[model samples]
Target chain A: MKILIIGAGGMVGRKLTVKLQGAGALNGQPITALTLADIFAPEVPQGGIKTTSVAADLSRDGAAEELLAERPDVIFHLAAIVSGEAEANFEKGYRINLDGTRLLFEAIRQAGQVEHYYPKLVFTSSIAVFGEPLPAVIPDTQVLTPLTSYGTQKAIGELLLADYSRRGVFDGIGIRLPTIAVRPGAPNKAASGFFSGIIREPLAGLEAILPVAETVRHWFASPRAAVGFLIHAAELNTATLGQRRSLSMPGLSATVGEQIEALERAAGLDAVALIRREPDAKIIEMVAGWPKDFDSQRATDLGFVGDSDIDEIIRIHIADELKGKIGRGAA
Target chain B: MKILIIGAGGMVGRKLTVKLQGAGALNGQPITALTLADIFAPEVPQGGIKTTSVAADLSRDGAAEELLAERPDVIFHLAAIVSGEAEANFEKGYRINLDGTRLLFEAIRQAGQVEHYYPKLVFTSSIAVFGEPLPAVIPDTQVLTPLTSYGTQKAIGELLLADYSRRGVFDGIGIRLPTIAVRPGAPNKAASGFFSGIIREPLAGLEAILPVAETVRHWFASPRAAVGFLIHAAELNTATLGQRRSLSMPGLSATVGEQIEALERAAGLDAVALIRREPDAKIIEMVAGWPKDFDSQRATDLGFVGDSDIDEIIRIHIADELKGKIGRGAA
Candidate 1:
C-alpha cells in the first residue's frame, strides 16, 4: 500500500504519521511507500517504509497535480486554514480552503482521465459547519447553516466530495471531526482554545483562564480519536455510505464543569485550583452560537469510536503526550 | 431602482422582465434603468424605463466584472445549465453553474471595495438540491444531499450566497423553486418535462406521454407564480432571513391523477383524453428519486405564494400563454 498525508506537519497529522509508521500496514496491506505533504516540508518518520516529505501550497496552480503525480493508493486530505484565520482574511480563506480543495479534486479527476486510477480519499471536515439556532442534540440530518466562512468552505467541500464520489472520479469519504480537546501544545488565539487550555494547562501545573461559564457545553474528541477516524474512514466499505459521503464523527459532549471535574479526578484538587475564573464576554457570545452536542448516530453505527468521557480524553492526552506522567507540582 | 436580470431570455426571466415593465416600480422605487444579460442578447422589453440587452457568457474572464460595472441596485441571477445538460456535460456544468456564480459574487465584492455598493441579489435555486431517502414532506431544515451534479452546484451556491451575505458583501436571498408546471412552449428533454407536457400538449389537442404512474407526486409552481416569487424576494426585508439565506419556495404538491382531473375540469374530457399512457422506464427511474412534497413554511411565512392547486396552474397557463382560449377540439 502507498499513502499520502496532506498537512502532515500539524499535530494530528504528525500523530497519524507516527501511528501509520508503527503499524507498518493499513487495512491489512503492507505500507511500501509514504508521502507527507504540507505548506512546509513535514518531518520524515523513522520506519521500514520509504518516506518523502514535500512542501507545497495546494491553492497554487499545478501544485495539486505535482502531488498526485505518484498516484498513492490512499490520500488523506487534512489541510485547512483554521476558523479564525479564515474569517480574518476572506480572500485568503476562500483561496486556500475552497479553491485549494476544488483544485485537488479536479487534479485527481484529470489524472484518472489519462488512465484507470481511483484512490480512496479521506477528507477532514469540521463541526463549525453547524451554527446558531442549533438543536440541543444535532441529528445526522440537520441542515448546514455555517455562520463562519471556514464552515461554509467545509460545507462546500463536503458537497463536492459527495458529487465527485458519485461520478466515480474516486472513492471519497468526509468525516466532520469534533474540536480536539487536551490539544498537545501551548494555548492559541482560537475561541475554542479554552476547551483544551483549561485541561492542558492545569495538567502541567500552570494556571489557565476559563473564558466561559461552567454551564457551557461543546463536543470533543481527543487527537488519538481523530486520527482513528481518518484511518477508519479510509478502511470502511463505501458501499454502505451510499451517495452521502460526509458524516459527523462520534464525540463526547461535556460541560465546562464536567471537564473541570474530569481534571480534578485525574490530577487532584491542585490541578483544578489552577484554573482561573476570568470570563471573557466576547468568547461567551461566540460560544453561544456553537453546537452544544450531536447525536452522531450514523458515525457510531458505522463503527467509528469516540472517547467515553472527558476523563478518557484527558487520560489519552496524558498517555500520548505526557508519557503517562503528571506535572511534579500537581502530583 | 436599477435592475439586472442575468438570464433574461429564459421563460421565467422573460415573464419577470414583463412584470417589472408593467409595474414601472419595485418596493415603491421607480424603475430608472434595466439590464438584461444572457448567453445571447435578450429582447429589450417595451417600457418607459431605459433597457440594455447584452450577450455574455459569465464563465469567461471579465464577463461578470463587465456586468457589475454599472452596479444595478437589484440583481436577479436566474441563469444556470438545466439539470439534464449539466449531468451529461460535466465540465460545462461546473464551468457555467458553479464558477460563473462565484465569479459574479466575487465581482460584486470587488466593486464594493472600490466604492460603497451593495446589491440585493435574488438567486434562483432549484428543488434538485433535494434527493432520495427524502421525507414525506421535506422541512425547512432538511440536509442537502443532492444526487446530481446540478443539485450539487446549486447547494454550493446556496452556501456561498449565505456566507457572502453574512459578510455584508451583498444582500442575498436564494429561492429553491419547485418544478415549474404547465411550462410554456414545446416539450424539452428534462426528466421533469412531462409534469408540464401532460397539461400543455393536451391543451393544444396533441398527445403527451405520461412517463410514470399516476400516484407519483412532485412539488410545483407555475411560471407566473415563479415570477411572483422572484419579485417578492427582491422586495423582501432580508433581516428576517437571518444568516440562513436560502428558502424552499411555496409550491403545490400534486400527483399525475390530480393533474388530469384538473385538466378535465378546465377543458373537458377531450383535453384529458389527449394524454397518452406511455411509461418510459428511464424517466420512471429518474422521477423516483425526486422530492414528492415540501413543507415550505418559511417561504409562506415570508409571504411567497404559489398556485393553489393543479387546476390553478392550468388556468394561469391558459390565461398567460393560450390567450385565455383552449384548442378547438378541447373547447
Candidate 2:
C-alpha cells in the first residue's frame, strides 16, 4: 500500500509517521511506499518502506496536481492552522484551510478524468464544529453551528468530504477528534491549553495554572488514541458511512477536577498540589461555549476506540512521554 | 440606495429588479444607481434610477472584482446553476455555485481593505440543505445533511456568509427559500418542475404531469413572497442575528393532495382533472427523501412571513400572475 500524509510536520502527523513506520503495514496491506508533504519539508522516517518528503503548498495554483503526480492508495489530510491562529488571521485561515482542501479534492477529481483513481481519504475534523446552546449530550446528528472561523472551515471540509465521497470521486472518512489530554509539549497561549498544561506541568514536577473552574467539563483522548482513530478510519468500510461521511469519534468526558484527581493518582498528591488557581475570565467564557460531552454512539458502533477514562489517558501519556517514570516532588 | 444584483437575468432576479425599480428605494433610502450582472447582460429595467447591465461570470478571475468596482451599497447574490443541471455537470456546479460565491465575498473583503466598505449582502439559499432520515418536523437546529450536490454548495455558502458576517467583512443575511410555486414560463425538465407545472400548465389550459404520488409533501413560497423575504432580509437589523446569520424562512408546508385541493377550489375540478398521473419511479424516490415540514418558529419570530396555507398560496399566484383571472375549463 502506498500512503500520503499531508501536514506531516505537526505533532499528530509526526506521531502518525512513526506509528506507520513501526507497523510496516496498514489494514493488513503490505506497505510499499510513503509520501509526506507540508509547507516545510517533512522529515523522512527511517523505514524499509520507500519514503519521500516534499515541501509543498496544496493551496497554490496547480500545487495539488503536482503532489498527486505519484498517486498514493491512502491519503491522510491533517494540515490546518490552529484555532487561535486561524481566528487571528482570517484571510490566511480560509486560504489554507478552506481553499487548500478544495484544491486537493478538485485535483483528485481531475486526475480521475485522465486515469481512474480513487484513494481512501481520512480527514481530521475537530469538536469545535459544535458551538453554544448545545444539548447536555450533543447527539451524533447535532447540527454544526460553529461560532469560530476555524470551526466553520472544518465543518466546510467535512461537507466537501461527504460530497466528494458520494460522487465516487474518492472514498473519504472524517473523524472529529477530542482535545488531546496530557499533551506532551510545553504549554502555549491557547485558551484550552490549560486543559493539558494543568496535567503535563504537574507531571513534570512544575507548577501549572488553572484558568477555569474545577467543575468545567470537556472531552479528551490521548495522542496515541488520536493516531489509532486515523488508522481505524483508513481501514473501515466507508460503505457503512453512506452520505454522512464524517463521524464524531468516541472520547472520555471529564471535568478539570477529575483531570487533577487522575493526575494525582498517576503521580502523587505532591503533583496535584503544584496546580495554581489563576482564573482568567476570557478563557472561562471561551471554554463555556464549547461542547462538554457528546453521544458518539455512531463512532463507537463503527469500531473507533478511545481511552476508558481520564486516568487511562494520563497513564498513556506517562508511559509514552515519560518512559513510565513518575516524578514525586513539586518544583 | 445603490443596488447590485449578481444574477439579474434569472426569473427571481428580474422580478427583484422590477420590484426595486417600482419602489425607487430600499429601507427608506432612495435608490441612486442599480448594477445588474449575469452570464449575459440583464435587460435594463425602465426607471428613473440609474442602472447598468453587465455580462459577467463571477467564478472567473477578476469578474467579481470588476462587479464590485462600483461598490454598490446592497448586493443581491442570486446566481446559481439549478439543481438538475448542477447534479449532471459537477464541475460547473462547484465553479459557479461555490467558487463564484467565495470570489464575491473575497472581492468585497479586499475592497474593504483599500477603503472602508461593508454592504448588506443578501444571499439566496434553498430548502435542499436538509435531507433524509429527517424528523417529523425539522426544527431550526436540524443538521445540514444535503442529499444533492446543489444543496451541499448552498450549505457551504451559508457557512461562508455567517463567517464573513461575523468577521465584520460584510453584513450578510442568508434566507433559505422554499421551492418557488407557480414558477413563471415554459415547462422545464427538472424533477421538481411538476410541483409548479401541475399548477402552472393546468392554469394555462394545458395538461400537467404529476410524476409522484399526491401524498408527497414539501415546502412552498410564491415568487412575491420570495421577493418579500429578500427585501425583509435587507431591511432587518442584523444585530439580533448574532453569529447564526442564515435563517430558514417560514414557508407553507403542504402535501400534493392539499395543493390539488386548493387548485380545485380556485378554478373548479376541471382544472384539477387536467393533472395527469404518470408516476416515475426515479422522481418518486427522489421526492421521498425531501423534508416534509419544518417548525420555522425562528423565522416567524423574526417577522418574515409566508402564505398561511396552500389555498392562500394559489390565490396569491393567481392574483399576481393571472391578474385575478381564472380559466373556467380545460383546453
Candidate 3:
C-alpha cells in the first residue's frame, strides 16, 4: 500500500509519519512506499523503508494533481498555516489553506477522470470552527460558527469535502482535532500552543507563562491520540459516515486547573511550581470564546476513543514524549 | 442616500430595485443614486434620481474595489445561484457566492483605508442554512448545518460578513430569508418554486403537480416581506445587534395543506380545484430535508415583520401578480 502525507514537516505530520512508519501497515495492509510532501523539505526519516520526501508547494497550479498522479492508496492532508499566522497574514492564509485545499480536491477529481484512482483523503480540521455561545459540552452536530479566519477556512474545507464526497469524487473524512497537548516541539504561531506549552515546559522544568486564566477549560488529545484518529479515519468505512463526512473527534476534556493537577501528580509539585500565572488579557479574551467540552458521540460510535481523564493524558504524554521527563525536567 | 445593489439581476433583485425606486427613499433617507450590479446586465431602474447599472462578474479580482469606488451609503448583496444550481454546479456556486462575498468584504476594508466607506451591507441569507433535526420553531441561536453547497456558501458568507462587521470593516446584517412565495415571471430552475407554483397555478385554474406530500411544512415570506426584512435590517440600529450581526428573519410557518386551504379561501373552491396530485420522488426527498419553522424572535425585536398566514401570502400574490389574471388558465 502506498500513502501520501501533505505537511509532512509539521509536528503532527512528523509524529504521524513516525507512527505510520513504525506500524508498517494500515488496516492490516502492509505499507510499501510513503510519499511525504511539504512547503519545506521534510527531514528525511531514518527508517529503512522506501520513503520519498518532496518539497512542493501544493497550492500552486497542478501541483496537487502532480502529487496525486502517483496513485497513493491513502492521502493524509495535514498542511495548513497555524491560526495566529493565518489571522495575522490574511491573504496568505486564504491562499494556502482555502484555495490550496480547493485546488487539491479539484485536481483529485480531474485526475480521477482518466481512471479509477480515488484515495482515502483524511483531512485534519480544528475546534476553531466553533465560536461563542458554544455549549458547555459541544455536541458533534453543533453549527460551525468560526470566528477566526483559520476556523472559517477549515469549516469551509469541511463543507467542500462533504459535498465532494457526496458527489463520489473521493472517499474523504475530516476530523475536527482537539488541542494537541504536550506537543513535542518549540512553539510556532498557533493560538492553541499556549495550552500545550504550559504543561509541556513545566514538566520539563522550564518556566512557562500561563497566558490565560486557569479556569479556562478546553478539549484535548495527546499527539499519539491525534495520530490514532488519522489512521482510524483513513481506514474506516466511509459508507457508515455518509454525506456528513466530517466529525468532531472525541478528546480528553480538562480545565487548566485540572491540567496543573495532573502535572503535579505525574511530575511533582516542584514541576508545577515552575509554572507562572501571568494572564494576558488578549489571550484571555481569545481563549474565553473557545468551547469547554465536546459531546463527540459520532466519533465514539465509530470506535474512536480518548483519555478518560487528565492524569491519563499526562501519563501518555510522559511516556510518548519528554523521554519520560518528569519532575521539573526530570522524569 | 446612495445604495448599491449586488446581484441586482436576480428575481428579488428586480422587485427590490423597482420598489426602492418607487419609494424614492430608504429609512427616511432620500435616494440620490442607485448602483445595480450583477454578472449579467440588470435592467436599469427608470425612476431613481441617478441610477448606474454595472455588469461585472464579482468573483473575479478587483471587481469589488471598482464597485466600492462609487462609495454608496448602503448595499444589498442578493447575488447567489439557487440551491439546485449550487448543488449541481458546486465549483461555480462557491466561486460566485463564497469567494465573491469575501472579496467584496476585503474591498470594503481596503476602501475604508481612504475615507471609511463602510456601507450598511444587508446580505440576503437563506433558511437553507438549516437542515434536519431542527426544532419546529428554529431559534435565533440554532446551529447552521446546510445539506447543499448553496446553503454552505450562504452560511459561510453570513459568518464572514458578521466577522468583518465585528472588526468594524462595515455594518453588516444577514437576514435568513424564508422561501419566497409567489415568485414572478416564467418558471425558472428553483427547486422550491413548486411551493409557490403549486398554489399559484392551481388558483389560476391550471393543473399544478404536488410533488411532495400535503404534510410538507416550510417557513415562507412573500417577496414583499423579504424586501421589508432587507429594508428593516438595513435601517436597524447597530447598537442593538452588537457584535453578533447575522439574524433569522421572521416569516409565516405553514404546511402544504395550509397553503392549499389559503388558495381555496382566496380563489374559491373552483380555482383551488385545479390542483393535481402528482409526486416527484426527487422533489419530495428535497422538501423532506427542509426546515419546518423558524423562531424569529430576534428579527421581530429588530423590527422585521412577516405576513400573518398563508392566506395573507396568497392575497399579496393575487394583488402584486395575478392582477385579476386569476382564472385565465383555470382548469
Per-prediction DockQ: 0.93, 0.77, 0.50
lDDT (10s digit) by residue, model 2, range B1-331: 7899999999899989999999999999999999999999999989888999999999999999999988999999999998999999998999999999999999999999999999999999998998898897988788898988999999999999988998889999999999999787788988889999898777877789999998999999888889999999999899888788888889888889989998888878888999999999999999988888888898888889887787777777777777777663321
lDDT of 1 by residue, A1-331 (tens): 9999998999989999999999999999999989999999999978878999999999999999999988999999999999999999999999989999999999999999999989999999999999988889998788999999999999999999999999999999999999999888889999999999999998988889998999999999999999999999999999999888999999999999999999999999999999999989999999999999999989999999998989899999899888888974432
- What lDDT would each prediction earn against the true structure? 0.94, 0.90, 0.84
Q: For model 1 chain A, where is the 10-residue window of minimal lDDT?
A: A322-331
Ten consecutive residues with minimal summed lDDT in candidate 3 chain A? A322-331
Q: Which stretches of candidate 1 lie over 4 Å from their true place?
A: A328-331, B328-331
lDDT by residue for model 1 (B3-46), tens? 99999999999999999999999999999999999999999878
Candidate 3 lDDT over residue span B1-331, tens digit each: 8999999998788889998999999989899999999987799968946888999888999999888887989999999878888887878998898889989998998898788577899999999887875777787777677788898888888878877886678899888999999776665667788888877776666777777888988889999999888888888987797656788888888988988888888878886677778888888888878899888887788788898888888878878887755776432
Which 10 consecutive positions of candidate 1 chain B have the poorest summed lDDT? B322-331
Model 2 chain A worst lDDT run, 10 consecutive residues: A322-331
Residue A305 error, candidate 1, Å:
0.6
lDDT digits (tens) for residues A181-285 of candidate 3: 878766555667778887788777788888888888998998888988999999899988866788998998888988988888877888888888887888888
